[model samples]
Target: MTTPLPIGSTIGILGGGQLGRMLSVAASRLGFRTVIFEPGADCPASHVAQAHIQASYEDAAALRRFAERVDVITYEFENIPTSALDILEALRPIHPNREALRISQDRLTEKTFLSNLGLTTAPFADIPDAAALDGALQTIGTPSILKTRRFGYDGKGQARLSSPREAAQAFSDMNGAPAILEGFVDFSLEVSIIAARSQDGQVSAYDPGENVHEGGILRTTTVPAKIPARLQTDAVLLAAKILNALEYVGVMGVELFVTPTALIVNEIAPRVHNSGHWTQNGCTVDQFEQHIRAVAGWPLGNGERHSDVTMANLIGDDMDRVPALAQDGACALHLYGKAEVKPGRKMGHVNRVTD
Candidate 1:
């Protein structure tokens, strides 16, 4: 299918993180130009893009100029302000559409959407205020999680309540924002499926990646998850259903909880995802390229896996381990050109492919 915007046309991208960086690199390979709109002066994505509009998300004039220059737009992150999207969409097309963005931005809305679709998820309830928190606790129980409805990522803006005493403190710590209390599930492992939906509504999903997290941050993701083949097929079908429901057009990441009873939808990321980094070395068509194809209205590429892979995130001081990691013959080390290595920061990743 030919895109509304053709190859060699410029694409505007929101956010300048590592995901945007990879998207820009992929766009360049496909003969498309990328104009990155980011407020920061030296973001990782700006290094690769043809143009960088250095302005805040709320800057309407800058946004208008960016929209005028690019043919179509897409974002790397879901936390983009709604007002900013309003401004950009008035000028150019934004893929995955506003409903996808709206559903993905809030945990409560996301859970409700999944439930409405008959998808299993952790039991959850809304916490409107301090008074509501007690009721939520009673309903969802202790050993549960309390997360803000919006703008939480990388384990930030969330608290676990194992005891009644921790509940009020968790509420107070969040500055009394709207929140959700979710009952914890006993899962064998966490997994995620990354899939792409093209302009013609065709969907293709990569093999699910089994993930392990530490201190609220992703630690590693291994493909061809050591799970039953039928379960993996179920995961892919669920993800495709989600994308098709959203009428989504671009790459999306669906995190899942592989429980004893069923696979539950954990969360949805409406763009290229961290757990999918292994596809860089393991798939015939990587998630980044697939996103570029979908948003540009090009044909989706093959999403076949070539070899089993383990993708390890480089967090904070983990950068120091690069030399040793690079020495391994099977490891492909990818570093984000960020100068400082702060705790919990995702600097890069290493994909180790094995037979």
Candidate 2:
């Protein structure tokens, strides 16, 4: 087992976004400090982190200095450049490991990994080129989505093909990138399990949260998702199986498509997820704190929910509603402290809690 770092130790975080910002707060609550490494200036995370390293991921010198200062390293996102990992891994321990990052970085690799573990996923075929796209379409059929294998999130890097006629446009949308065609799933609802595993291999999962999306971005997450009792049990068990398979330490978000017949794995995020934001109001130890505890080599929390919560994201224009939302006594407002509010950008979120 890895020895736990002392309370005063510094934790290095890659990627400075809202997730990193929240993580910094959690670490501070536990008496640990955090330093953020991000390329962008005035990043949301930089507002709260003890220190911010403003450098590109490939900046070897910056990465070296970052690694030297922190006792342990973790990331808020999975799109970290491999070159950067080479520099950081040699200096400090990275939680959830490089193998987990590799698998989750690409959609094709993630699906293949899940299938090999006997887990169910949406039927998919890799599209290396135009020819492969045709072949995959012939097999997977129409009404499928062609998505870039890497660096996709919040509805980006994807094109929908309703039929064969739209194939050309969809493939052209890829912009010469490797892609994957996923067969459409007639799911009833989307739910995700926020699970965490400790260094010694103990795993715990929060109650699955039902998700609602708008234009590919997560809009809201309702805890105690409207799933059957047996399905909820299945969700937690499948999530545990995934953590055990990866031998992962730290938190993971496993998205699942709840069909009438079975649960299909949609994708897995190797860090705390947007869908888990509800945990902040509903659980004693929220996802952020759970992640900090796990990465710090501390024991996992119980993850028990004490109330129902509905977390809604304040997207671009949604910020206009913040004035009214802030006035509601039952709501808890958490803003990212971002200066600009572009369309589709997440500004903040509010959690409505009830017993």
Question: What is the TM-score of each predicted model, taking all chains together?
Answer: 0.98, 0.98
Q: Write the per-residue lDDT of candidate 2 for residues 1-355, one digit (tens) a residue.
A: 7688799999999989999999999999999999999999999999998999999987899999999889999999999999999999999999989989999999999999999988899989999999888899999998999999999777888999999888888999989899999999999999999999999898999999999998898999998899999999999999999899999999999999999988999999999999999998998999999999999999998799999999999999999999999899889999999999999999999999966
Model number with the top TM-score: 2
Residue-wise C-alpha lDDT for candidate 1, range 1-355, written one tens digit per residue: 4544566999899988899999998898889999999999899999999999999988999999999999999999998898999999998999979999999999999999999998999999988898888988887888998899998776688899998789889998788789988899999999999999999998999999999999878999998898899999999899998999999999999999998779989999999999999999998789998999999998899999999999999999999999999899999998989878998899999999986
Clash pairs detected, candidate 1: none
Model 1 has an lDDT value of 0.92
Give me the candidate number with maximum lDDT. Answer: 2
